[model samples]
Target: MRAAIHDERGVAAIEFGIMIPILSLMVVSVTDIGLAVFRKMQVEDAAQAGAQYAIIHGFDASGISSAVTSATNSTAVTASPGPVKFYGCPTGTGVSVVSAGTVCTGGAQAGTYATVSAQATYYTLINYQIIAVAYTYNAQSTTRLQ
Candidate 1:
């Protein structure tokens, strides 16, 4: 009985067996998070691509939408809310929209601007108790056309 209690045989195996599940969980969690981050970047890039298209070719709703959708490899990405065209003046915070041909407070002329938005739904491989199974990612980009 004393020898049996003192036996170290199979201890490494037992430890490995206990650690296997933990290590697997950690690896899978990391992979899931990495994928989520990658998808978010794709969404952001899609929005930026749409804005760039509008800046280069002017704001065409259909063309901007197409650019957003085609900018990423993921088919889940979409151009949400389409594209918007407005006249705005550059401000300290951001673009301040006003009437066309309106002069800004700083004596700058209002410029035509386009905004593009992209959205995607990310579904996790595994659900966690604290985290949701599905997450929505949205991105927007704005650029001056003139």
Candidate 2:
């Protein structure tokens, strides 16, 4: 009975078994986080690409949206149009543009401002099954059109 109690033959195996689940959980969590970060960066890059295209293309809604989609190259993310606000101030601090080429106040010109933005639906991998939580990721870029 004493020998049996003192026997530690299977101790390593028991420890390993206990640690396996924990290690696996950590790895999965890290993977999920990495994926989320990658998706976010991709979305931002896509938005910037669309904005750059718009600056040269007169801010065509369809074209901008297409550019964003193409940049992302992911079916999981959907690109949508964002608001186009104009500003007389270079910093866009005062006044808003009401029309395509007009500003609500100040000396801001209509063709002086343009913006491109993209929004995407983000799904969490870990809690997707337990609770359906969806997040929206939005990115925007603004430029002055000559």
Candidate 3:
């Protein structure tokens, strides 16, 4: 009876069996998070690509949208809210919209700017009580054309 109690045989197997589920769950969770982050980056890159297209090719709504969608391998990405053109003065952080003829506080005249946006939906492999299974990611880029 004492020998049976002290027996260490199969202990490693028992421990491994107990930890398998936990390790598997961790790996899956990490994979899901990594995929979500990568998709978000793709969305952001798509927006930037659209803006670049606008800067080089000028702002054609359909053209910008096409550029955004084609910028990424994922078909789920799209140009959402469409592209917009406005007059704005360049600021330290970003462009500040103003009248076409208006001069900015820094003495610079307002210039034409275009904004492009991209969006995508990400679905997780598993749903958790603390977080939703699906997430929406959006990104936007603005560039001065003139």
Best by lDDT: 3
lDDT value, candidate 3, whole model: 0.95
Q: Report the lDDT of model 2 for residue 72.
A: 71
What is the clash tally of candidate 2? 2
The per-model lDDT (C-alpha) reads 0.94, 0.70, 0.95
Top candidate on TM-score is 1
* Each prediction's TM-score versus the true structure: 0.95, 0.78, 0.94
What is the Cα-based lDDT of residue 92 in candidate 1? 90
lDDT of 3 by residue, 23-57 (tens): 99999999999999999999999999999999999
After superposing candidate 3, which stretches have Cα over 4 Å from the reference? none
Q: Which has the higher TM-score value, candidate number 1 or candidate number 3?
A: 1
lDDT tens digits by residue: candidate 1, 1-146: 99999999999999999999999989999999999999999999999999989988998999999999999888999999889999999889889889998998878889999989999999998887798999999999989999
Task: Estimate the TM-score for candidate 3.
Answer: 0.94
Where does model 2 exceed 4 Å of error?
83-87, 92-111, 128-133
Q: Which 10-residue span in candidate 1 carries the lowest summed lDDT?
A: 123-132
Model 2: colliding residue pairs: 88-108, 101-110
lDDT for 31 in candidate 3 is 97
